[model samples]
Target chain A: MPDRSHTRPPRAADLGAFAPIALAALVLALVPLWAGDSRSMMTVVTTGLTFASYAVAFNLIFGATGQLFLCVGALAGIGGFGSVIISDRLGLPFLVTMPMAALLSGLFGAALSWVAVRRSLDTIFTGIVTLAFALSFQSFVLGRPELTGGENGLQVAGGADTLLRQPVEPYYVFLGLLVVFLVVYRVIQRSHVGWAFRALRDDDAAASLAGIDVARYRILAGWIGSMMLGLTGALFAHYRGFVGDTTYAFGSVDVRVLVMLAFGGIGTLLGPVLGAAVFTVMDELLVDQAQVRELIYGVITVILFLSFRQGAVPALTNAVRRLVGADQPPPREASSADTGIG
Target chain B: MVAVLIDGLVLGLQFGMLGVGLTLVYGLGGVVNLAHGQMAVVAAMVAARLMDRGTATALAVAAGILSVVALGVVIDRTLMQPVYRERSEHRVLLGLLLMLGVGFIIDGVLEWRYPIEALSLRITGGPVEVFGVAIRRGSIVASAVIGVVGLALILFFRYTTFGRATRSVIEDEEGARLCGINPGAVRTVIFGLSGGLAGIVAMTQAMTSPVVSTAGVGLTIFALIVAVVGGLGSTSGAFLAGIILGLVNTLSAFYIGTFVSSIILLLAAASTILLRPEGLLRRA
Candidate 1:
């Protein structure tokens, strides 16, 4: 019932947050300049951008609202499969199918949030339930081989004639998506919705006492975040011209996204992008030694969770602050957003 | 129908054992061992490797379980230190993520070294009749072992002084500490016991179906679902939930298809959270 809108000028911290997104966009905009001709390089970067987008979406749901939707891969899979079926089977336009798929995913996410809220489940319980959803989604995909193409996956023919088929064009498309997602994240961070998110994340019972509609805001975050995941997933599927269960499996996608978000900074605007870029490069470097790469990734994940819980960006900023003799306790905005039960 | 029920009960007993391991850790340390299944796989792999080297089956299995117990203690002493320092939600999240990493590491290493290795414990016997239906002798033996272990756990927790100390810590760590109970030691012991339980379940599972290197994640998922449905920290609840889920699983697999059974099991777990977030039987 409160007027959760703010028409006042943005604060200095809020404006400062946009700087990283702009810099990221500018730097990424020029990626196509050098890697334009090399198809493999473009493909890799484009794939990295896709994950970057997924990480950003995850950040919105988790870092903002403390809803640990472990089914990142599942929601994206929904979008990927939905768009593929609608566009390929029904012969609909990519534009129509993409939004429909995204909306469907958003609704599913909202429903998950509704269930979580209605039950008053904690973070881990929410994670468990979503994880169950993720496992079932994988089974469903594999169980219905006739429609989903089973383990072999389906060849996406819907966008074969479009710019999506072009290597460089698809790279830009994913990059564009990543930039837009970052902007959306920044916008949310500066809004009254952001205020409500912070309150509930800090103390849910207190936030509800202060007249914030905890359930509504959590669902809103889940819906919007899932829509982003769905949109990016569908776009990635069409661009790659394939969709499969493994494409969004728990081990393949969810693990990497969680690792990336942790390495980058949970709540920071640039964290997901930074984390994605680093891991993308690491992924490429160890592409040949898959097992070894996974082992290394596992070690890195453990180390990050233990020592670098605040993530690389925050750590770097803190170090820089200390160097500049501005050793005021790290800014509250950059502190850990871990919604722990006090 | 009777054969399926017996098979379901067999599998359910193992599921109950797995849930007990997970629930104990969650109750005592507020840690969710996402690597629970990996521990089982590692133990199975150890046993398989030993058997290949001509070790006695019983000795190999013992060594395997001990190895896992040591692994659990090491993890509790080292990695879980920071995790335990965290309180409530943070502790759960950190523990889950770190254990997930551990699972990945185990999976990566085992797959790299033993891609073709699988543990299949062959019991020399004929089919046994139960309730007018023939059931595999191996299944009956596995179920018997699990039943004994489950009973031992119940009695251990019910009557033992150390078990009472453990319950005290889980109920109120501060109060237990004030009463001179070392919560840290209790947690480490439970973690090791949980690891041992996981190893035992893996061996029993191999009596029914091969426990391969890649079975880690799936095993973990089953354990998680059982623990969640039964209630996070209740031993008896785990067994009850496991039996129920096991029956549901076998029925769905029989009526529908094997592929859809997993989906059905997951749905059951999700609905449990929706309908009964506190789980079937609260804490121990």
Candidate 2:
């Protein structure tokens, strides 16, 4: 890989672009406070934030990198199971087991990316492989009664109260982690590596010719994405106070994760978080009519995809640009120079 | 031991029937059609309904197949055709969402109409004793049918002009279009054929076991694994993979246990993607 580090100074404006992020954070923090009985509201907020992390991890590849991985839930499942096995079965502490689970999940993600990155497999093939992985993961978990506790699932020792010691604690923990991940995401998006990722997304051969290590970037994206998923899985397991193989099974919470990601918009940084929040509210409102909930969600997602192909975030950004009466920025010219490893 | 092998082979044939249909669609259309398994459920339910209305077994099967073909055509024309035209990255995602919605609609309608009560149908003959092993007559008929259909499909794809056109489009769309082939027409035919095959598989499997809405998703996932493990775009690959998977499933269930058997199969499928990403059978 060519070293392009000395070509230009790092983009300083991007680092200072945090006004919107701060506003968003403040809004989230005040949600429970305004809702009153802040406990339940905090619980809901924590859950949404945790899921948003998974979506963000997914967006690393799906959005910025342009690799669609349908097995996000399966990776999360791996993390959840790993944490449960280590913390509950092997008697390891939650903190220790959580990182271990995240590491293993990243390894699995890398393994998956290795199969997918080079082949130029179409979207359908990617879906097939990822879906198969998800199914296999579920089957393996459910089939192994000894290891996974079968359909009954493994029960962790502590509930949310035990870990957080109070509802507000979990809320703060999730919010802090969410902010940190967002920062990491934005930083990566503005970095040379991030540009390489975007380049590969647009055209792999061109990116490769430009000296970007496409395969390595894809693998790295998967690894990073899986690590985020693992973190969320661990947090979920701890919060729920139990882990079940069926938790990530098809048509269960896994589908909900996909819906949230899609609803918020693929490839956008803030879409997943917004999507999660929207879905949670919708789920709460439609709790009674659960049967038709997925149908409605699916329909809405289809409509959104049709109307806003680039996703809600981009669409909103474009609208803001138009409203401000600013000329649309010209597309960036492709750099002919070689860069460091993607 | 002989009985287990015989039973596994028969079950494997039934799975192959379903797997081949899925393989064909994926090969030609590049759509996974997550609703494929649910199509089987729809077929089985239709057959059961026909039987309840005092229809003959043959007639029930025919009705099931016909209904599935109609449903397939409708799906291809409306939901799938638009996605094909757009040719967007979201096609697969949208297809998945649409199918999930369809699955829900079908499940809801079926549950409301027929309920989940089990219906056991005996296809008239007693178990045949062959080489001191007893095999159900229904299993024998199902296996023979599957074998015949599989052979016919191979022959059609190999020799027929329509088959050549389909293969041409699958191999190189631009090249085929230059040669005056309509990819859309080929897609429609393939989808219809797949639906009919799914119907047959569903009918046979349901006859052997029982049909219910809850079983739809499980069977779809099972068929998907079989298709992927065998090879995504190869019919022969799917057939062979299904048999291999069936044997592994049976042997594992018998020796290790059902749970371990499932795990082993899952691990085997996953490891294949990691090791041989192209799958067991490579389509030339």
Candidate 3:
């Protein structure tokens, strides 16, 4: 079995990757000032930020853990419902509803992880299971029309007004959440738990033999990832001022989530954000040509996958590292603790 | 109650036919051929076109099945063959993308040819009163055909040398290769056969209900759900699960409304995974 315990400090190569993300964020932040259109700029920034957060959360399981979960959209949809229900039905404050929504989603993720871990299934089976979960949740929400607003969807009265009332407010709120999630993610990535996650992701049996408690780490990743997704979903619902069954529909937004994660570079902290930005911009530009957009999207995805298997971010980082006269950091050393276990 | 049960059986049989085709491709090739549903749609549309041209029902069905088999060969040779050698997780993902692309292309061609509304032909036949429940003769015919075909498939798999070769390849490709079995040839034949089966099922379904371009996407999703619930690689499991899902869907639609029925089906599939991750039937 391969070593599963070697840990490395954040290298100079890591800083090069972080530089691009920081620059992009700075540019996005200064966009309103340059464009002199506060409203549209705010919308773009907030939308991009929220989607980035969702993508990042999605990547935790998909990119980092190498688990192909198809329910990110539904999880976010659930989070949206959670926030909307708390705020609209129970009349809780947005601040209160947000954390509660995230918590519920995290718990939901944990439960899913528990099932996934216990089953000892392969990735494809896990994917199918999650896809089923997404469909089920969508159905449950739509069936209980009183809760999810069914097909017509539930409108949060004055919901958009509450946030859009102040353009800067929405932007700042999104920025704050994005920052918090990113910080938490970065810190987690540097921790032992994060290393455990990587180990399990690379090889579960080997990780288990290395005393990584594979299931526990997987569950933790799911919990954290889902919490972030839930939070983003709540913000999106509030921003859009509605929550509907269609919002969580699989094969629609679900495909988009996968596209975003892949486009941005799965597994990297900054990949999702970049992917989301590019996707949003492309979507906006292509919205006029509605008939051919899907075809184009499919073509691009296939080409990208065929050409750059590591995804765009990792591929680009590798190229940049090569250009900058930097030694490609040695592959992270796997812990050599377990030998002859079989 | 009797009506619901009969309806459930009819729908279940239909699902069983589709599920069987799906299991063949998945079990033999490890390729989730998302294109399975599209093949069914193509068959249905071809049959519809033949019927429009005043062809006999039997001839139309035969042509439809033949066309589907031809398309399956095309697919296997072009899109699927390139990726067959490397059976990685990424290949499965790529298969999904390829199917999605192919589905879109099919949809585009279909939209150009057929109108948006669903097209159907009512078989002029009297209803049969069974146990005090009046049911369409068409439903009875569909059930009988499905049962016969399903039984034939079971027999073929159990008794035929081709079936043994197919099973050997499915169990262990390398071992099969060592035993001098050509995996590629086996896969191509199975894919073509499965596509033919899908075509027949699609034609029968369109005859029973209506044919529409968008119906292809819905059928694909339904087939996928059915296949997953039945277990990806288990034929008997798919058959049983299809019947179960068909009953659940029909009864739920009757009692809970159409939209809710779909939701219920989705939820049931999800719950099944939660309960039995390997599926109800574990194929050896």
Candidate 4:
């Protein structure tokens, strides 16, 4: 049965729901003032912003479209590694290489989604296929000695540092990107494209019957998400000044992203941002112990899935909304921000 | 040619041991169990630690299997229960994420104790000539052990009442419920059985190459691909797919580079999924 609850567009100009999130981001933005030129804090905040970008980009496909593409890490790797090649070996400008990296990753994502949609593969199957793609990327990087520098990884050139030297500059760069993308996320959510994605996510057959080209929109989702990931990777590569197989490949980066999204909330805009900030802060506090880091993440992942399915941010948001009386947002409107694929 | 076939067959048998549990768990629960590989690693750790301390190999193997079975049941009851209760489209997603977390924890825990190095169980002899084909004793012994166990499992599924009940649930949960079968209990039994299979696979790994804590993902990927390609719910299909993949892997490695083989195998899996999602052998 078609859900009447989601039949209409959500009330526009109702931006009050986003007030809490804007406050949170504003608080995060003040870390620069809080640190007062501390390089470590600046660096940690920069990392937070970068991963927040990653998680948000991931949410576009995973959260909005309900596609579980595990190869986001690999897509990011392509951007990171591509930057190494373009900036260091090719010595291209940042503008040129950044877009190039984004294009490469975006195209790969599109191709993967095309394959999935064209064949009408299940979401689980899509995950499995992308996982293979992820493994393939790691294997490729690990096997290539000269191009990739093998396990030790390739060092990126100081091309980006010329534009932004201090930790503050790169930190702001990432923060700026996060702010811009958050706006972009809102735009995408309210657009016709967003409705199509949510439709397919809810029911592909129904979406198809309703005259939506499910394959085309799914590919578009993949393209948008991966392009953002690639852009994030390119910036991160320059920001970090290095790109390695271990840092960005299969299990490491993807696992962190998955855990963050799962914990913070899969469908919410603030969820990934909140998750990124929290995990990033936790990461800085426990920098040396990889074991402890994984244990905590694992424990959180299980706990969130078990007891907190709506994720922390959404659950919190819903509670507050409930307290304020019956101005409950339409299911479709609040869905992209609250309901996960589950 | 004969040697290649022999090598592939034995390796395939071992792969089958690795994959059966993953397939069963996925089939019964609609949960991917991302920690599937770690279960085997836990078994290997137990066996390797016991044998390293001078315990008899057979006794250590039995202990390892039992330990894994117990752990599997615990995980299913505690971690998997809620995931199964969820009725959302992303219920599998929740399970996958949870299992991924569990995998990370297991990896971290294993590395904390095992030093991130390879741990092995050695067979006492070198290559032996079997019907004019030179084969390593380790492969032969590993294959024999896993094959016997596989056959026993097959027998159990075909003839046992519990196995029949499990199959009924897998085939038609509503009908099975109507017939008075408790799906939850059957699921728990399958979890135990799957864990035992993981233990067997670990022992196979022990008899062959040493497995490291970090190699858990590698094991999981291999098992998942085999299960996916074989047909999601069919044990026999997974077994056949394992042999086919093993043979193809060996042939590709011989013809191309070792890394090429993995890429090729992965591509093959992708093509299989896109082209025949129900699997090459599975009935739609």
In angstroms, how far off is A164's CA in candidate 3?
3.7
lDDT of 1 by residue, A44-142 (tens): 989999999999999999988899999999999999999999999999998789999999999999999999988888988999999999988899899
| Candidate 2 displacement at residue A270 in angstroms | 0.7
Best by TM-score: 1
The CA root-mean-square deviation of candidate 2, after full C-alpha superposition on the true structure, stands at 6.1
lDDT of 1: 0.85
- What's the true lDDT of residue B263 in model 1? 88
Q: Give the DockQ-based CAPRI class for model 3.
A: acceptable
Tell me the TM-score of model 4: 0.91
Per-residue lDDT tens digits for candidate 2, residues A175-198, read 777777777776786778888877
| Candidate 4 structure quality by residue, lDDT tens digits, B154-176 | 88889999888888888887799
DockQ of each: 0.58, 0.30, 0.39, 0.58
For model 1 the TM-score comes to 0.93
Off by over 4 Å in 4: A1-9, A12-24, A158-160, A309-342, B1-4, B116-119
Each candidate's chain A: what TM-score? 0.88, 0.83, 0.83, 0.86
lDDT (Cα) of model 4: 0.78
Across A286-340, the per-residue lDDT of candidate 3 in tens digits comes to 7787766765676655554444443334343443333323321111100011110
Proportion of the native interface contacts kept in model 3: 0.36
Model 1, position B80, has a per-residue lDDT of: 95
Better of 1 and 3 by TM-score: 1
lDDT of each: 0.85, 0.71, 0.72, 0.78
Candidate 4 residue-wise lDDT, A187-285, digit = tens: 787779878977898888999999999999999999989999998988888777777888677776787887777656666666677667667766776
